[model samples]
Target chain A: MSQKSEGGLQEQVAQLYGTYVDMVYRIAVLYLKEPAAAEDAVQEVFVKLMHWLARGRLQEKEHIKRWLIVTTKTTCMDELRRQKRQSTDPIEAGDFCSLPAVWQSGQGPDGERLREVHDALMRLSEDCRLVMYLFYFEGYSSAEIAGMLHMNHSTVRGKLRTGRRRMRILLEEDRE
Target chain B: MRQEDIREYFRSQGPSETQKDRILAGVLEQYEQETQGEFHMCTKTKRSVSKIVAIAAVMVLTTVSAFAAVPEFRDWIGGQFGLTAEQEADLAASGTLQNIQASASNGNLTMTVHQALVDEQGMYIIYDVDSDDGSAVDVSLDDLQFQASESAGVFLYSIEQKVLETREDGVTCMALLTGLEDLSGQEVSLSSCGLTCRWTVGETAEIQKIEADLTGKDLWTGRPYHVTGCGLSPICVKLDLDGAERLQDSGFPDQVAVEVANTDGSVKTIQSVGSCGKETEDYRYQMFLFDEIIDVDRVQAVYVDGVKLN
Candidate 1:
């Protein structure tokens, strides 16, 4: 790719850094379930972003976001594949259940509740967790989310219902 | 805990600024390592670069003008929202459309509020984002939110649909805000960070409401549905559907296609974008937005999936 001037490249990076860095990190954490791995994924995605900027392929903010979302998800998926291939131990649900160390290590006012919620979230399947996150947290309707995630609308609703029910049961079990 | 609590829990978790800055630094370092020698070696002089940029700008402008002249504001609303020309005219004649000129700026980015089309259900805000410093405008409908004036008592609104079109200099966005109490003639503020614009929602178009409680089976899916409420105007039809828990069934259809039987025995189809189903604790609430507005006085009966519910 043809390179932009160093100053121009820095400006683009600075503009996107504050806006999307946390989002990229959070999405990576959600998918990879390991802060260290997620951080590596974030770096990879940003490096790819630099290439996009150098190529002048991105025209606007919306395009950048769409690209980031797809790229981050793909990066996490590739990491998961690599982990599965590398691990000698059996790949199981418990293997991917770690909440970020920040939430697990620190106990604030809402720490216990946060842990409970995070634990329940980690227990759900990856698809369910993503659907639930987009629906409840991001406030996207099932149809809109289906378009974003490229799933059937019915499937989005199904995952949401299943996720909600499972989270409720898990939280209740934790309380007991 | 409730769904809102879960949302809050996730929302509160993210990497801190220090981590973000570290990641950015790493990215920049990697970029420099990857592109160092090639970048400086290929760099053009400032004068030649500016000449090329100016030529490219003129060519881009010519191409933009030749291929895609920005549609007039009303035409944009009609095209974006799928309204017909007659429907657009009816909305204007009924005083449902208002021209609004409100704007807010943050640094190089400026968000301008242009016009609003209001109905009994909600309104569509037409706006555009431009960057004065020639940077790419990076705003989305999710970034923009509406809050009623303090006196309006904490009203809630949902963006049902958004249409974005990229233009030469900026991005134009039309957002349909629904699921709110009547906002007619009420002062509301829309803001995204430092960019804020306040305007009064103009007088809503006078539309007819048909209180519907008709239950029928969908012929295509053989599933049952209830029409809880409906609104009619010369330009649009808003129908609310309650699936009564059948929405959870696999293969449940979203779009409840409606065919309006006119009084003169002609049938005019009220095209739907699709079924927008939002599940609640007990029922599935589906909203049907018709693309074409029809003559309300002539709509004798409305049929869905071959079942008449009028």
Candidate 2:
């Protein structure tokens, strides 16, 4: 690439950093479950980003969100692979169940509620959890989610509706 | 807690803004160590078009990146040009859109549809039209169009398609058939029916000049283009490429991508340039739609060599 193009690439990556750094961290932590490991994973994602740009693979700006989330998940899985845990076992193996020390470490009622809700969300089945995150937090449609996750559109819908139902039940139970 | 409360909590928990800078700095530092460039934060310019819009309104900005990848952003584009959200939903849910891989074989030319992207922008069929006999298809905007047999949806017809690449077997390109219409639950087909000219690599582009409001240079040609106006409301860019249109038709180079920086320090990338209006004899008028919108007054469209167009 020319120097000018490389400069543009640098600028685009910098912009991506400001916009997606936190989301990338949250996504990495959602799977890695540790701030330290998640932080490390965040670094890995951007490194992958440099490669993605170098190859001229990104066609449009809208793809950054999906690319970050998907890449973080894949990179986290690679990290998990090194740990010898079944990388595909998102919720079934109780991987993300425990809330990290810092998140629950906040003081008072709001903190407790945050911890409880976080725990409950982490405990939902993998498909439901991912569907819920992509839908509510990331703002992806069921159709877009299906395309990204490589699942049927209807299945993504089912998981999302069911995910909400499951979360509602868990939160309602926590109140009682 | 309600689902929204959980959502709020999920959104709330993450690295702080300062930490974001640090982590990103560290990542780039590591990348530099690995790739070996003069890596530093102060020198880099971040892509900020969507970020600025995102900060002002999350709901509006999220859906663009959250959906279309640009072509999927057709509705947002349509909504700008007078299409309703309900209409967009109906078209999306119609499911009448067809995806056929059928091939069109002429004596030395063959056109095949790899896939079709249907959204608010209508149907863009990415196809391969190649000639083993080394025959070149006319790259003019007027000579190409769609021939719909059966229809359930609207079809705003056009013959202009941007040929992205020319491969040994065929050329990969995208054709925008309509704006208000779509292929959703409809029967549509595109062919090089009226293609008369054999436009080869050495062929010159026929982009003429048009009248406009604002004036901006074509950077490469040093010729001023008549830009009617610049808007941040769904951000429309009208650039009349005089000598530069040659690259679009032939596989030559017109290298015209820009980053518009707002006064508030946000940058937006302008790509996938297409025509929005008629052609002029001395200029090839084209427009690029940026994904996000800015407050027009504050927009500083930064070009190469610090040429700012507002």
Candidate 3:
């Protein structure tokens, strides 16, 4: 890239880091299931983006945003797989919910409710969690998420519906 | 638990303050590293490379404006800088908020050190520089630098400063500190090595900054005066204390009358005293108003915190 062209890329990279940092952290926390691990993944994700930007690989704002989300998910998945390989004991799927909650500090009922929602969200498959988070919290369309996740649009919609049902059941069970 | 409500709830959910600072600090650190080569605004001078090297020393959490011991000042400063409430709370809780405040006034210009918060890696300062004349004066981020006389150990990692706002009273400024050690507890001074501020009132519009000599001439508070001691060993001068403080700025305490009486009936008044806090208040080692090392004999009268000693 020309020296003049690199200016926009640098600006966008700064924007991505500032604007969507929390989004990246939430996604990483949902998959990695630990605070330290999640923070590390968030940093690694940005660092990777920087490396890409340095190499002149990133060109557009929208593309960089999608790349951040996708790469955060991938980074967490790799770490989880690495953790599983290291465990001498067999790790089960349900073990994720049972994993110690990286409970972020909040106050009162709203805080409690959000914690409950996050706990339930983490119990869903990483794919479901990512898709549902994008659809609801980030306000991404199924088609947009489909492209980012490289899944069929219908498949993304199906997961979103199922993820909603699962989260309701988990919260309701806690209440009972 | 409606799905929509829960979605909204999760949307509101974000990382904790600790996690956010950790993430942002890491990311910005990387950005600052690469961006320095690309941050092209302050790099026009021959000294630009060194200035860039200075800012490359350490990173200060971003700050925008306000100076010193005023409550209204802090509030305005908080709003101006991109500091979150959480970060302010953190700095307060860490005791960095109650930092050293120093001020200096030359005959023509007055500079006040409003707030300086130092951490392990750096310190941040908010200050105001006002000309008594109050015409056109400017201190760019390019001009402000930090140097601690005592702290020779710490090296400048990086310095990011901005002239936040300008008013007739003075120009509001903020500086980001990056260093190897904590500077909050230390006494440091601000310098404008390539200070370019000027008063357009003069016949030629005298550059106030050019008048600011970096060779220990202009201090943020008062010009530092050097006085030599007269002691008994060589019989040059005994009990003649050096490094006395002059009544210059608001930061200075009240002056004590110190005089070195010589056999020749010549007595010199010392402006400031050197004491170790509340205890061991020794005023014999006073800053005598002497540009040259004066040779005196015999002991002189000492005033320890205004209490005269016979």
- For this target, which candidate reaches the highest lDDT against the unseen true structure? 1
Chain B TM (all candidates): 0.58, 0.33, 0.35
lDDT of candidate 2 over B217-294, digit per residue (tens)? 434443433334332222334454445344335333223466667768888666533334334476454444333332
Superposed model 3: Cα runs more than 4 Å off? A1-12, A88-107, B28-310
* TM agreement with the true structure for every prediction: 0.42, 0.42, 0.39
Better of 1 and 3 by DockQ: 1
Measured with C-alpha atoms, the lDDT of residue A107 in candidate 3 is: 62
DockQ of each: 0.12, 0.13, 0.10
Candidates 2 and 3, the one with greater DockQ: 2
TM-scores for chain A, candidates in order? 0.84, 0.79, 0.80
Task: Tell me the chain A TM-score of model 2.
Answer: 0.79
Tens digit per residue, CA lDDT, model 1, A76-175: 7656755654664533434543445555664766777777787788888766877777677667789776545544456778898888888889889978
lDDT of 2 by residue, A38-151 (tens): 788899888767655644545355665676776676566556544433335433323543354555575665777777678677766644776787788888899788656544
Compute the DockQ of candidate 3: 0.10
Error of 1 at B277 (Å): 37
Docking quality tier of candidate 2?
Answer: incorrect
Please write out the lDDT profile of model 3 over residues B58-112, one tens digit for every residue. 2211111110111122433345444444333223322333323455676567776
Per-residue error for B223 in candidate 2, Å, reads 70
